[model samples]
Target: MHPSIPGTTPDTSSTTARSHPKHLKRFIIGSVAVLSITGLVAGGAFAVQSAADSRERVAATRALTDSTGLQRDQLGAYAGIAEAHTDKTASSTLAEANQVLASTEGKADASALTAVSSSLASFESMPIDLVVELTIETQTETAALSAAAAEADRVAAEAAAEAAAAAEAARQATLATTNTPAGAKAFAQSLASSNYGWGSDQFSCLNQLWQKESNWNYQAYNSSGATGIPQALPGSKMASAGNDWATNAATQVTWGLGYIKESRYGTPCAAWAHSQANNWY
Candidate 1:
């Protein structure tokens, strides 16, 4: 049995309220823990800032390089970070990096230096470590590409040279074994009788003196400037036949016929190819 109060009716609700109070106390403890955690986190961040501010630029660079040094890519990244800090004098990050890379010497580690330069070149924008890795990879690839292109160019140039030499040799051989003026008459006569191309027209006017003197001597130079079988006064007048017209009959005939055609249409039927092929008429 319960003991009864003297005046107020005994309130059973008070017991219920007391029972819930423990849960409220637990919530207060949890809030306090969250506040403590937040304070610790903020304090830690301040400490890190103070530590960073205490180091010199060179020391900072060394630290970065040391941390990432073990990683193939990370070392390069650290090197870049060092470079970025190296240019303390420059206004921009990259400019500052440039300054360090330029001024750092015996104290500077070459591998680290290279990594810094390589990484810096690769970045449009990025953290120093990643920039360095990108730079190293890109430089290696670019060098390889350049070497391949140079090799290809060398091969192409050699082939072109060989081709030019072959063409020159053939041209010299043609000149060495060309038909003489004496041979021209017999060849022309035979061709004339046997439908000598182009309507078999009479080139008799051109054939008159050539039959006796040069006989179609393309190399017939009077050195005195009397040139070709037709022997035009100036010798150079027959140059239309070939650039070697003065020394080559094939050249002279080419020029003579060209003169006749351009000045006289096809009435004489002098063609550049026919003259070269048959030697003359």
Candidate 2:
């Protein structure tokens, strides 16, 4: 054993100093590991925050774009609804175009709105009233023309009907004349010769007169009470010839010849001349 010296802590401090290096190394290593872990956790947290921020920014941008699209779509729908008016109020078209311009608001750019406004102005500047009036006038004129054409067609149809009726009447007259009895001419000739002293020269005149009056039909009747081949006024006047005057051509001819000879018309030719001038003998 060694005796202690006063006021001297001896070399104990040196031994402690030599031993402290290992503890210091261990503490530094532990501190470095803790700092590394803290750095890694901070980096991960920063990355997560950045990603969240980026997503939020994208969502915000998309929301803004969608809002703009919705605004534009609503504007277009309003414009479409306003554009379907016509008739006498054609100026409503300009009103609708103006509405389209008003609907653009914040959704469209200034240039786009200006273009739409210009179009509306141009539409409003046009003479819509004049166009409507002109259209009405044109329609009126067209209707007048159509009516005139229809009238012309009606007139043409009426004229054609009248002509057809006249032709049918002429055909009936011809048929009646062709149906004359074979003995009618001979009977007329015999009666004219015996009673009126008329020869073959008067035969033609008698034939023309009888044909014009009754188509040589003994039973023929006229609206004026005239009847038989001579178309005598009052069919009963032919009864002087015979009771069968209406049915017999010979009886009708005998009575007619006697009447011509006794009256102012002394011959068939004179009676025919009178009939030609006055449509009656």
Candidate 3:
């Protein structure tokens, strides 16, 4: 109005100021969008980290649980053996038993660890539990032999024991005998220490057969055609004990025991019956 211009008007300054308001609004929108994207990215990273931590915790828990289970099983077995002491504390057998307890306390596979638990002193203890069980049922049968021993007859005891030993030797001599290796007898004893259920019937039957088979000889062997302690018809079968099945009692015992467990369910009487029926154990 003061100086009327053809192209410009008094309202031009107002329009320019309004344009600044729109630009300010656009800037605010862009800042908000950037902030939203940043927040989303941070939240996603946090979620991933939390998930990884949770998985790690889960794995740790599983490992702890497995270790605890093995420890408990081994502990219970050791406790059972510790409760049943029949000999002097200083006996080598007792020492080996203690060693077995100590060895089994650590983490390891059960079967492989069987060889690390015992010593030669514990070999006789292997059949102690088994003998106890058998004596209960078949004590009458051994009564003549026991009576013979008690009558000032170390001769009878020796003869009977020798006979039993001979039978074992015979059996072992024929088949793939115990394949555990001589050094492993102690280890087997450790496992035997845990075997609270081993019985006399098993002992008697085993004695009767194995004495005739291997004469208590761990390394005794029959001809290749004859095969291990129980003398399986085919020598090849004793390989279940080890590749050197023909020479090892551990391998033989493992396989023979498996057969008894599977076919006879560890009943020595059943094994005896089968032996009687088949003429081959």
Candidate 4:
């Protein structure tokens, strides 16, 4: 209550004080709204970033799965070749790779996938060298076997030729002793027994038959065109036994025995009986 100055008569201190509180309340509400909007925007950005990270992880897992499948297929093909060659080292590596692939199946862990991929890379080239070596070895073994077979065949052919020459010389030596008439008779007896399966009893019949035909003489010839020890229809007919049929008693005897056995007589005794009955057998 002092004397009024020029234009200061009102005392509105209480009103100013009340208005200050209202302004404070409005400022508080606006600040709260601004903070709420900022929180929503921040949350939305974080959620979008999180979703993007999840998509990247899914793509990485898919890529890893594809890579692992391709690696497994290549390893399986190599393993088949290794097994065919009976290579134990390559087989072991393939087994280890399969185990690693099995452990990482359907997994999305990046570290596990990386480990498996690394293992596969390390194992990939291991079987290649072994396969190449095995292929070379197989080819070499095949060549050696072929060479050995050819050599064996050559040796067998040489041995067969030598045996044939030895057999021919022995036959020539035996025929040289049959030039005389007594030796020719003895050779005929031996030939009838060994070649015709005829014993002494059948030999008696064969001897009588040939003696009547040619006097057991390989040089005998008939005016009717029969010749040789057994009186073959033609002298050259005994050439079936040897080229020296006219002179070799063994040759003529061999042909005579075969003729008696083959001409439906079956034995020299049977031929003798037929000759006695028909006079032409």
Q: Using lDDT as the measure, which candidate wins?
A: 4
The residue pairs in collision within model 1 are 77-129, 87-96, 119-132, 181-215, 181-216, 181-217, 218-248, 218-249, 241-254, 241-255
- Against the true structure, what is every candidate's RMSD? 19.4, 32.9, 33.4, 26.8
What is candidate 3's lDDT per residue for 88-185, written digit by digit as tens? 32243334444444544432223322333223234334433332333332323233333433453565677899999999889666443334333333
Residues 172-267 of candidate 1: C-alpha lDDT, one tens digit per residue: 765564456655544454444454343334566346535443557765556566566655557877755566765555556555555544553342
All candidates in order of lDDT, best leading: 4, 2, 1, 3
Better of 1 and 3 by TM-score: 1
TM-score to native of every candidate shown: 0.47, 0.36, 0.30, 0.40
Deviation from native of the Cα of residue 257 in model 1, angstroms: 1.2
Q: Lowest summed lDDT over 10 consecutive residues: which window, candidate 2?
A: 30-39
Cα lDDT of candidate 3 equals 0.45
* Model 1, C-alpha of 17: deviation from truth (Å): 46
Q: lDDT of model 4 at residue 182?
A: 73
| Ranked candidates, highest TM-score first | 1, 4, 2, 3
**What value does the lDDT take at residue 108 in candidate 1?**
32
Candidate 4 regions off by >4 Å?
Answer: 1-126, 191-215, 235-248, 254-281
1-281: candidate 2 lDDT, tens digit per residue:
22323422122221222233432221111111201110122212321223333344345434543755544335334333333222324445334434544553343333433443343344323333333443344444334444554666688799999999999898566445433655677767776777667789999898898889888887788788999888888989889888877766777877888898889988889999999999999
The candidate maximizing TM-score is 1
The whole-model lDDT of each prediction reads 0.46, 0.57, 0.45, 0.59
- Model 1, residue 4: distance off in Å is 58
